[model samples]
Target: MNRSGKAVIVLLILLAAASISLSGVIYYNLEKEKSQTNNLSVEISDIESEKARLEEKIDEQKTELSKVYARLEQNEKKFKKLTFSIDEEKRKSQEVVSESASLRKDLADTKTAKVDLERKITQNQEELDSFKLEIAQLKKVKDVLQAKLKELTGDFDVELGKIVIGPEDASSKSSPRIDATKKKSAASNLEGKILVVNKEYDFAVINLGARDGVSVGDMLSIYHKGNYVGDIVIERVDEMMSSANFLSSNTKEKVKEGDKVVYRSS
Candidate 1:
């Protein structure tokens, strides 16, 4: 009971102390490992969430890029169409300009032609006026020459004697006796009368006839109370009557049934 019991009690106390120390060290290590594991799990979860967000962003960027590409293609097409329309419009404008130039040239040519034609017409009109004046002068000269011939021919005296005395003066009882020399003198100085004026036939009937020397183609004059009325040509003749046609006349002065007939001495 003495030494061996004391030694056994000491050994028991030492074993209990050793056991308590080992348990405390083991519990502290376990708590530290658990904390490290929780931290690692939280970090992994955060990395997974960040990776999903990055993938969604990448998809959205791809969609936007696709829209941009489509817009660029549409713009290119619009540009090409606009270029074609501009070229067509330019071609049409050039054509219009060319047509306008051609029309202007034609208008200028027409104006020049009109001016030339007007000038020619004026010159022609002047020439025609000159011709008319020349004709008038020639007519006056002809009339003068005709008057001179009538005076020289002595034809008017022969017509005068026939008009004054009726034809057949050689055998009529009522006929006046006329000497040959006196008859010649009377032929030079006789005036006459118109027995009938036939307007429908444009002729005058006179008492003078063939026997008194009246013949066809003889010219006679008509008068009304000493005023000259007209001129006539003998168309027909008989022994006691003759008819003459009015050659040139103005009938403003009336030639009635009893108007006087005469012969102009040139």
Candidate 2:
């Protein structure tokens, strides 16, 4: 019960209270650290799950990318084929244009040739007409010459016949009765041979002449090989030969050289 004894008891009581407070503080700190560690573990597990989901998304994107690349390759092949077809069509078009040009040139040449042919034909026709005109003019001149020659030849043949027949008296030449009698005598038994025949002019020449009683306007019969050929009329007379033109009515055959010529009464 003294002051020292009481102070010692109080001090012991204070120490006991302090030790209890420290033990309580240490237990509370240990419990807080255990709770914090459990929260850290939960956070790590959630982060790992999020990483696995992101990887799966990346794999899906890669598969889609491969399909897109395949489709792009197919489109490129189609483009190449289209380009080739377009080039082929262009070549064919060029060939057609060239052919058209050639055809046009040929057509123009053909037209030119046709025109030239027509011009030549026209020139030839003009020349032919000119030749025909010249022929007609020659025919007219020949007819005039033939008529003049016939008149002169008749007079010469008469004089020659008088001289060869021993000369006629002047009164006998003037007498119509004497002339008629002479003509009647000349009509009998007159025969001769054809010296020449001209089929183009339908005329013949005979050996019989004025001296043989052949005169202009006398009718004669023609014969070949005993067959009657044709009839001819004396056109011109000479001393030794006479020219006669054929008659169309009874000309059964063409007169030939050496054919027989005989006088016939009208």
lDDT of 2 at 120: 55
In candidate 2, the residue pairs with backbone N, CA or C atoms under 3 Å apart (3 or more residues apart, or in different chains) clash, namely none
- Candidate 2: tens digits of C-alpha lDDT, residues 69-170: 555455455555545655667665766656545545554554555455455545545554544444444343334334434544554454444432212232
In order, the Cα lDDT scores of the candidates are 0.55, 0.59
**By summed lDDT, which 10 consecutive residues of candidate 2 come out lowest?**
164-173
- The count of residue-pair clashes in candidate 1 stands at 0
Question: In model 1, which range of ten residues has the least summed lDDT?
Answer: 164-173
- Model 2 regions lying over 4 Å from their true place: 1-187, 249-253
RMSD (CA, angstroms), candidate 1? 76.2
True-vs-predicted CA distance for residue 39, candidate 2, Å = 99
